[model samples]
Target: MAEVNFCLGPHVGLRPAVPGIKRAPDPPESYSALELQVAEPPVQQLEVISGVESVQLPCRTTAELHDVVKVEWTDSGDRKVHVHSCVPEEPEDQNQVYRDRTEMREDPLRTGDLSLTLRFPTVRDNRTYTCSVYSRAGRPRVETRVELQVRAQQVEVDSGAESVQLPFETTADLPEDTLVVWWCDEPEPAKKVHEHGTESDQHEVYRGRTRMREDPLNTGIFTLTLNRPTVRDAGTYACRVYGAGLIFLREKTFQLTVKGVSVLLLCAPTAAAVSLNVSPNLQQFFSDDSVSLSCVVGAQAGGQAVKRTAGGQTDLCGSGFGTFDGSSCTVSGLSPSDSGVYWCEAACEQMSQQVNISVCPRNDFARCPFILEIPALPVTAGSEVTLRCRNKDGSTHAVYFFRNGVHIRDTTMQRVKVEEFSVSEVQQSDEGLYWCSTDLLGPSHRSWLSVRAPPAPPPPPSVSLVRLICLLVVVCLFCICTVLMVLMCCSRKTGNKSPVAMEMTQCFGEYDDIAAGISTEHDF
Candidate 1:
């Protein structure tokens, strides 16, 4: 018999089973069995084995055995197994599966011996069994569970086969809340392949390739139909059952060996090499740039394309923002979210090649006015100049100034707020192409500036030699007029005397001195 465990609570430890001593039935010469009261939903047992001639289902009671008014037994499928009725005073209504296959121990009614003996048990009889005991009057009903398992089995299947089914199954009359799970036994913790419940987390590898049979409980077919079985599918398959309260009723494992070619060859081409390439070998793509990805197969055709985004999920190549042909894929208006790895899968080949892609958003500097203004161009070397940045539309966009294509300063402004970047003591290095832009998205108008040394000073004001000569001539003429006037006055005063004439002559001679003196004065 397989080991069975009972769970009372998740945090609590397991409850050990009470050992029961073997005993013979009463009136050994003439065997008799009683019908046990069946629970609305059948109760499950802990353990049972196939190929057993007889097995004892033990039940314990705290009250006296004689005081027990009635005891009942039911199979995992809610099938009537046996009933011992003290009120009716008889055993009846034994299910056909166990009609003459059941017996009671001696003094059961007197000793409260609620144990059941199942005769000639086989694989078909392997299941959960419930035993319920009811006392006289106001006593509540007591229920216990027992689960049974058959020996391990092995099954074989063909690789690349359309479908493979596991033969394990449960009876049709299961409770509405029955849950079943099929999983791989090895690779410990068991990889789940399929499940039937409110929630299930099936393994990714088995997704879309595995499913459970329809109406499993009613058809007693717990088989899992795996579509397109591969060699990796060959492993031990386990099926576990749960009752209404999510109680673990039973579980069984079967070794599955897939026969045929290796799964690797089936899933992929032999010695096939595929490559992924992007046109223009773009490391960064603008938002509106069109992108095309080509799968270059080495002497092969029918390559399948796939893509993975930043989230590390593999999806069809053109599923999102692209259209994929057999050999290539194209995407337009690539955004930041489109950055990830792109994969190319060659037809009939398990191998794939991937290339990383990056996308960037386009900047629109054209949206805002971008102008660079130099206060004065061809400016002096030692002059302070301001480069005024302005936008005609008066937007508060961030402005970046660049000199000869190199960024100089970045600033933000409000409406009509000019970015006055001053250059102190302008130098040769400051003479270059200067441009301002709202952002890197668009182009900006550039202007050049030239720096040079300061100009020479003008000569001081002075009089010419010609102008001095002209002034001297004018002074001589004025002196001559004054002398003539004085001579005229003397002639009028003294008339025609020889002595006067002689005196005049002397006077004239003296006058020569005076003229000489005047000339001397003029010279001074």
Candidate 2:
């Protein structure tokens, strides 16, 4: 029964039930307001799938087109993708021509995942390629780009006069259709003295000095060696290739220099014998008359002396008298003019010695004479001749005497006293030559003396008168006798001498008295 029961004053008690919407349970307190939280997928990373970082290839090769190509692709997005294909094609979509020959494969794309696979590989297929992928979540498609290269074997050389090294490398991915050509630059003007590769292939200068280093198979490196280097082998060398209607080349250059070796000389003194000292008291001579000189070497070993001349050429003068061991020499003849420059020289092994000579004159008593003066003396019989002798300057103490040139005695007496040297009792034997000499220690002169007799009184005038008278008488007689003899001789011969005889007889008596007068005078 639907009985209405009055409950609390608000309404009668009648419950309506619903199956799904019974007043929804009050929302939980924790979720009273809207709070949205979104979840994100892991970010993708980029990676390298190709082995090469960068590449250089010959332009002449076409064979790269079909070579088994390797391509790399990476996922760098916030989501995963499934790779569909990596396609290689010409820039103008020319890949269509080789569609049937193309092949590709890829690895699953996860976070940081990258991978590659070969297409239908052949050398002729070398070209740029592309990688494509799609996301499973209906995301945008992902794609990556790649380049295919074609290459020929390349070699480069650096040549020096002494040696050469050829640098070479091969590409594993080179197209089968590529064509390679080997070449070298034009050689210099120098003669080919050496060859590295072979006489017909590679050559260098300096004969018989070539050496080469080549790896087994000659794939990567080749070098040429030489013994001696020269200036001629400097230039550029190259390797070239021709294919695909194009030319490719590689080259290198070398520089060089050369060197050599040399010698020199030197010299010393100007003149010959050099003067050193002057003797006989040089100082006593004037400056113009004094002397001195010396000799020396201007340069030591490896040198020569200068030639000197006074009027004409002369031999080189050396100190033959005072040479010491041939190294040092001295000379002792000096003149006032010799006081100038002088020099001496030694062998290459010895050093040079030089000196200047100075000459001054001095007064030397030991070399010159000292003179003395003597006074004259007068003496009579039994008297002495005292001769005073002294030096010119009167400074000398000791005195000496000489007779003629002979030495007599030496004394300190200034005045010579002699009591004897006279004729005693007036004897005639005492008269002779005599002289006095004085000593001045050197040369001395002598004084001369002459002895004479006193004159006799004139004959008495009275005696003279008588003698005169008698002399007259004798003269007359002598004349008479002479006449007589003459007359007698004439009478005997021819009786014609009367006048002559008379004259003779007249002179005879006078002649007799004249003879007696002469006898009387002799006696007197």
Give one digit per residue, the lDDT tens place, for model 1 in 272-344. 5555666754433445667777766666555666555443344676676588877778887777567555556
TM-score for each candidate, following the candidate numbering: 0.32, 0.18
* Top-TM-score candidate index: 1
Q: Pick by lDDT: which candidate is best?
A: 1
Candidate 1 shows a clash count of 29
Candidate 1 Cα misplacement greater than 4 A, ranges: 1-151, 157-163, 228-233, 258-260, 263-322, 328-524
Error of 2 at 27 (Å): 41
**What's the CA RMSD for each of the models?**
34.7, 56.8
Candidate 2: lDDT of 416? 56
Query: Which 10-residue window of candidate 2 scores lowest in summed lDDT?
Result: 58-67
Position 417, candidate 2: lDDT: 38
Residue 124 C-alpha lDDT in model 1: 58
